[model samples]
Target: MDSSSPAQGAARSADLAALDVRITGCRACPRLVAWREEVAATKRAAFADQTYWGRPVPGFGPPDAPLLVVGLAPAAHGGNRTGRMFTGDRSGDVLYAALHDIGLASRGTSVRADDGLELYGVRVTSPVHCAPPANKPTPGERDTCRPWLVRELGLLRPTLRAVVVLGAFGWQAALPALTEAGWAVPRPRPAFAHGARVTLVRRPEPDAPGTGPASAELFGCFHVSQRNTFTGRLTPAMLRQVLATAAESAGLPTRSPWTS
Candidate 1:
């Protein structure tokens, strides 16, 4: 291994850590702030003894990860409760199980922030950091939270090679963020569909460095929400298929779902 690799990795980790801190501290959207706080204070009956994260949830995973999983926003009772994206939620249960089958996740369940879950060459995040009411964030709130995504994209450019966006909302939100982060999104922006795929190239700059990946593949998959999963619109095998493809495109090794 090259001596510079460790140093570079450390620097990237530090940058992302700083970003997460800033993300958790954000209160840019008044309505989201109020709603998340109210939900946190209400204390769900099952979790009354536990403390709530209550603040904006930051993206979870390693800084130099090669794959990105994008979702709509934090769940009011899930991430807003555990301080971790996707944790303590049914959606997270399905997604993580699929990821584990694809060899991108360390475990099949993500129940809490301290659950020892780990992701391999993949990072999970959402367009909006704060949980929204009725599981919907206003378009205005989405726009307000975009800069964080843009910054995260920029930070991950060095190693990022693929992105799997769950749901239309995240797809729409990610395009502008990716563009702002240096990728040249095609004109007539592509529509979102389960199993859809697109390749995005980095916009050329006068002094563009050649040390990092110049392009990233983007895949679309249905969100792992109860509505989709329960209705069989997105099955475990189907979700794993998309994630496996994205993982391979990101240059990460994946295990076949059919294997033990």
Candidate 2:
């Protein structure tokens, strides 16, 4: 749905809230939670008593969105601290600005959820629901979290048009999962880079009763991490180009969210 419409936005917000409620209290990985709690406690004072979300971070976007943006995981002081994907951090600053410029974001500000930020035809989520130590999740932990992503993709079914992986890690994590679920693999299996677009084609018809591919497009690009952006690895122009390709694949205009 487009931002020019109001009713569609309201419906999508409710859908996102439903997903958020389901995992808001999750403690599926005790080790991760314990570590998260410890970090939160240690930083609570330094953070001026800002309480941690300390729970599973949920994906946010339109339920039937054509584009899905996959990120690595929650940052300890970002999503983990603020309870919203890509919020309260430098990484989010880069991401939200690009999204806003691309028309996927309604509000340019992503410092906090209360800022009234909204995603239009795109949805943003991470492979790991919980924040990990030093932002690094173990292989086992990532595997354990795969089911949640599977369920989310299924729920957003039928309308999914393109998938944008925001980093090599996210690409590595999600590509196999999408392949296993029957989506086509990108020709040459795109390596993560700024403005790189790998076209994944899903058949107009269902798999031939047994062995066929699911219908979907897959895109990849370098993440808008602090390291990437601050170091000039991912430039603003590069991010815009990548998003423009993503929107084109999803059959949307690319007027850019930043200009408005």
Candidate 3:
């Protein structure tokens, strides 16, 4: 098309290529791979042989986004099937709606990555990349998967103003990384109650490896899983409250951009 178009395309290509490298070669946990593969093979008809991503799903958002949305893990038939965060599922439906209302989503739907959806000023990722059995990941598996999460957050360091954990487990998984980086731990730790905000000032700590004393904030909420969304545990108003708290924690205006 235009001169600048080619350059833009090249930059996008390089970024996606790097994401592919991380996804395809990820072997942080063998059990996760085996379980997902088994699920993929046994449920072949449902997927029409399209194949499962069966790998780590990287976070989706702008590189310099100031906000990070963290989910617990991928959904077996959702992200694992569609190869995108919070896509092809109910959890995604609720999340996207809220995001759109809040002015974070560039689109209303996210059935697939190519669905022309984009996130502005925000990134979405899961602590455990692969879909876990019964949607529950073993502590060992979560531990093994921590390094990638650490690296991803580090890369987004300066711009990562605040993180909104979608569930208790997500908060738990993120705790070690933040602490290791010399960030403050939540007083009572990351519990499942919604709208909790913990802010830590960043400072250099020789004892803390792989993280600077860069201050960060953590927001807690219930997971937007099927159980939570369908059972009314996480209503649109509830999610908005959580988001507002997170934004406020990061010194953003407290008004919600989206309607519940």
Best candidate per TM-score, number? 1
Alpha-carbon local distance difference test for all models: 0.88, 0.73, 0.71
Per-prediction TM-score:
0.93, 0.83, 0.82
Question: What lDDT tens digits, residue by residue, belong to model 1 across residues 64-116?
Answer: 99999999999988999999999999999999999998788999999999999
Model 2 steric clash pairs: 100-257, 100-258, 101-256, 101-257, 101-258, 102-257, 182-214
Best by lDDT: 1
Question: What would you estimate as the lDDT of candidate 2?
Answer: 0.73
- Displacement of residue 82 (Cα, Å) in model 2 is 1.1
RMSD of 1: 6.1
Checking candidate 3 for backbone clashes, the offending pairs are 101-258, 202-213, 202-214, 202-215, 203-213
Candidate 3, residues 1-260, lDDT tens digits: the string is: 11122223223333434543465456557777877777666655657767666555667777776778999888887887777889878899888877876667876678876889987778888778888889999998887666556656655666667888888788888888666544667566656558777786665545544453266778888888878888998898888777766665555544365544
Candidates ranked by lDDT: 1, 2, 3
Candidate 2 RMSD to the real structure: 7.5
**143-250: candidate 2 lDDT, tens digit per residue:** 766655655665555677778888887887887666644466765666776555665655343534433224566777888888889899888878777777887778
Q: What stretches of model 2 exceed 4 Å from their correct place?
A: 1-19, 44-46, 186-190, 203-214, 257-260
lDDT preference between candidates 1 and 3, better one: 1
Clash counts for all predictions: 0, 7, 5
